[model samples]
Target: MIYLNQAGYAPNSTKRATITGNNHYNLFSADGKKILSGECTLEFDENSGENAAVIDFSEVTEEGRYFFADEDNFRSPEFVISKNHYDQALRDSMKMFYFQRCGMELEEKYAGVYKRKACHCGGGYILGDRFQRRKMLGGWHDAGDYGRYVTAGAVALAHLLYGYEMFPGALTLNLNIPESGGSLPDILAECKYELDWILDMQDEDGGVHHKCTSASFCGFIMPDEDDLDMVITPVSSLATADFVAIMALASRIYHKFDEPYSNTLAAAARKSWTWLIKNPSFIFENPKEVTTGTYEDLCDADERFWAAAEMYRLDKNEDAMKVILGTMELHLSMHCLGWADVAGLGTLSIINSGTDFFGKDLYNRLVMKWLDEADRLKLISQSNAFGITLRPIEFTWGSNMVILMNAMILCVAHKLTGDDSYLKSAQYQLDYIFGRNAMDLSYVTGIGERAFKHPHLRPTAADNIDAPIPGFVSGGPNFRPCDEAANPDNMSDVPAMKRYADDVRSYSTNEITIYWNSPLVFVLGYMNSL
Candidate 1:
């Protein structure tokens, strides 16, 4: 199996393909003519422990479709070299959010073969607040499960918005959502679909519910078949803080197009921030009755910092700035820019907000801090056999998101410093997802020829389609195998990078989520713009 970018490579760029096994390979143009100057090398892979054959086409700069063939395999997938490489991919990745919408019918025209009946229309409860049992309806389904989580949704939205905010007109494409070619950009329109539900999750007092979920995980059935009671879980600091950040961010974007709606978002954000101030220490724990996904975060200083950063950006609140700066000393110790730990979010908000609250020198330092981290990750990625940004420890659940987040940070670094290397590294990470790394499979469904067909998606399972829903990105290559369903694959004893199984039961590697797709959208849109 050979892995090359599905959308192809750019001319005069370093173009390479990975194949497993010890053998020489020859690059061939679409016309079956030898294309490369030198022989390929088969080296031991540190990431997968496989005899990784690397076919380098960096020196072959002609812009044309080509493939590799040798004794170890037949013909590899065809790839091209052109400037507009990721154009179609960018559109497909953005359209994926349309498939993840909850409480809505996926019409045949928009969803194509992935269309489904309306589901999860049942409203949610407020759990234990004064407005306990109050109605909250309509949000994105978290992962393959029929649940709506605030923390995950907030992180996803913030990244998507950041992508839009950072590169103007990047997400300007019409995604063919219900609001395509509307007054608002299609990205914000799709975001509004989720925001409406998020607003419903917020209480009158400004606190946001942690999640709206069923009593238990839904069976391997369609959304319409899942009849469990939908209930809103208790409010938590993580959820409210995330809410504050997303709402404030959304308010800023919507203000330009829809002033009235922007005011509503701003008011909700302010209200949530007030509630967070009073209950800053509140931690959310799932009730014993609820057996759904718990997006629990124990330490919420980062979450608070994220919310404060956004709040300060929106209103220039001195208190918010003080809180953000007070947390700055602890920010350097932060890890990945993942949904779980949003320390990077606060830092990014400060860097992009254009507020001199932290002073110019400090702001410049924060920018350097992020770029330095990207530089370190880039070095690590470049050394790996697969050339992925993920370290050994990052191969946990939702590892694909981790990789995409790395690309997001690298893109930010590129924007800050105008460094071509950072942008190129970012594009390389995106290439890995589109099928240019270990496993030789595109983590995104229905995109590349070798993409995953059996994602752990409810609609895909029930729709009985031969192919999974297009554009849904799987949680690729989980090194730490946790699911009993995935144990039969014998991946637990395998090397970290080689532990992935494409089985539908392998939720660790096969599950799809909005958060994962969100970062993909951000990176793809940014790359597409370039």
Candidate 2:
């Protein structure tokens, strides 16, 4: 979405100026220029009588100027072209949280990499522990600490537009600003405490110890005397998928920005990806072995697909291609058990595989499955006896799986294979999502249903938070990713969601969600080919 240069992150290509009219303001660039409105069909002329604004790139003579989004002048008309493109990049990020929902001015916080779920102009940036903030990505760093791993991904993204900046010790990376304004670790160059701790929890083989964390980082010092008040944890499930999800995210950013991939970081992700692909289980008994468990216990669908998809982006290997195609088929076909029943969410991941596996029969098969499946399921509704879905359980609760991922998948499928049916499916979701946006006509509320809400910051400590956790433990590579893991049924118990709007609400923050954004980038990316 952002015009990252050939060299990764900020390149000489973006130095030139460009223009972005307020044509699609309400729909695309909502809030920031909310008053500016125009139809797509509006003809452009000197006196079009519409919002006629232009981003003049006339000052640029070189490539670097074109790719760079000068922060000091970020809101300048001179950098309009690059800004509009960069703003489009926010579509994916917006899914996670509507960055500009109500605020007229864009917050500098959302300008960089964000790790929170809902950062509308009103709320600023709020960190959400993945499970508590599952509507958001529900990944490892969802806990909202604004730590190092998050910083790495943020830095990589910022590099594409704003290279490492003036902030020292920002929460996210050098490129990204943190909630607390601290610099995060470069997960690519080196594995941070979070990854290492999670890694230590796993066996040398690929089986991930459900909630047990691996302390791969330095010397193990016990917590300070002050930590006695903390609730210790153990046996928490560390999702292999979560690890891969972050890797995939960073991978996409790095690839876009043209940053050199670090060996340790890359190898760690490669190992996780290879193991997950080979074993393909959600439960990580050992990092090497992801054996089957309760269907709901597997890592999030988004993480798995990203693992495969990013690998394809990086290597373009048939093996990785096979893995993505096969995984999507498995979930779509027979895996429609508990949470897996809701068919639409996985569409993005599945269709992403289709796009990557372009020209291949397998890609077509996956797309066909989406069309056929949509027909079989009908529509996503909990009140309806036969809601358009393979499994009712997944459809019952308001897990984001039904809203964000479903629309994303449909659109992606349509984009990958130019079948009108795929477009229809995407429209089906857009119809519902956009309808809600029109109804509220204000901010971007979640689409479809309301997912369960857990505590953003739990009462338990790093050690105590783990399921079947041990007691009285403190300190050492203090972060834990197990909380990001959730069961399929977690969707069903959201009592509070019952009070929210229907299955289709405003487009769930299609602003910050990696799952939603990656597919958007891929789909628009492919469509742009035309």
Candidate 3:
């Protein structure tokens, strides 16, 4: 079988595919006319423990639909080589957030066949005090569940707003959401839905709730069908700090369109900054009775650094700058742009602020650190058969997000330095998500010839639609299958790359999260802009 990007490739991009045993390959047009032929070079893939015949057809730059045929009679899925190859996928991925919106009726005009009534619209009671109800009406559902979490939502927003900031041209398309004709771009408008909810999560004291969820996970049912009581979890330093960072960033982005709302965000950010400074070590844990997702973190240093960095970027506050300088080494050492560790996001904000804010010496240092990480990821991609930056141990839960995030880092490196190598590495990572893996599966739903269909999302499972909602990214390939549904028939013993089950019961591997899709949007937005 040929493993390549089923979503296709950009015409001038490096086009490569891997076959298990075939040593020769031919690229054919839609009508079976041969366009290019190449001899495959054999490479040992450590993840799959197989010798892969790698096909490199980078010379095929014409805009047309094509496929590969191997000597062993295996024909690859048809894919397009065009400048607009990623346009549909990018739009679908962005529209995914609109589909995930809570507390609002999804009109048929916007949602089409997936349209549904408003869900979870009732005000949520404070977890410890049932009598105290707060209006928690909007925001995208955090993941496969109906929960809304601050840390996750903030990280997801960072990906999106940063994408808009860096590539405004790509994200300016009309997504046909309710805010389609608004003054702000549709991307920022869609994000404001969640931003409003995030603001509501902040208490009078400025601390933000960790999450708003039921006491436990509900059965698989439509969002409106599930009658579970929503409870607002207690505030944590992590949530507060993340809230500060994202609110600060959003304030800047929304300032041009809505100065009043932007000022509200800035005020909210400052309040949260105060809360973070006062309650510096407040880490949240799930109360004994609550059985929902915890999102508990052991340390809040990175969150504080990110919050401080954003606050600094917002107004050049000296206190925030002092915090950034104090945590500069720790921020530089951190490599991940995940929910748990967001110092990288803070670094990005600082880097984007330019050397005028931070001295030239410090700016150069940060640039060097980013380039060095990109260089390391490039080497890792070269060493692998799929040309992705995942090590064997890195194929844990939510591994697909890791792939996209690595691609995001490579994209940033490309922008920092005009080296085409970084961009190529980023494209390879996108290719892996589209197909180009041992499973021959596109990790995104409804996007490719063999996209994964069953996501662990409750609404999709209960919608009765034959296909899951489009553009929600699957977690992908967890070596340690935590659920019995994922480990059926001793499937956990398979190679890490093939350990994925398409079962909706396999939440560890098959679940889709807002943050996961956000990076996909960022990467796709960047590619489309190019």
Best by lDDT: 3
In model 2, where do residues sit more than 4 Å from their true spots?
Answer: 1-238, 241-253, 256-259, 273-359, 374-395, 399-401, 419-431, 434-498, 501-530
**Candidate 3 residue spans exceeding 4 A from truth:** none
lDDT (Cα, tens digit) per residue for candidate 2, span 243-335: 444454454444533445434445556666666766644442222222212123344444455445556655564776675666655554521
Q: Which candidate is the best by TM-score?
A: 3
RMSD of each: 2.1, 16.7, 1.3
* Superior candidate under TM-score, 1 versus 2: 1
Per-residue lDDT of 452-482 in model 1, one digit per residue for the tens? 7888877777777787767888888777777
Residue pairs with backbone atoms closer than 3 Å in model 3 (clashes)? none
The order by descending TM-score is 3, 1, 2
- For model 2, the local distance difference test gives 0.30
User: lDDT: which is higher, 2 or 3?
Assistant: 3
**Ranked by lDDT, top first:** 3, 1, 2
> lDDT of all the models against the reference?
0.80, 0.30, 0.88
Task: Give me the displacement of residue 61 in model 3, in angstroms.
Answer: 1.2
**Candidate 1 segments whose C-alpha is farther than 4 A from its true place:** 40-42, 71-73, 128-132, 331-335, 355-358
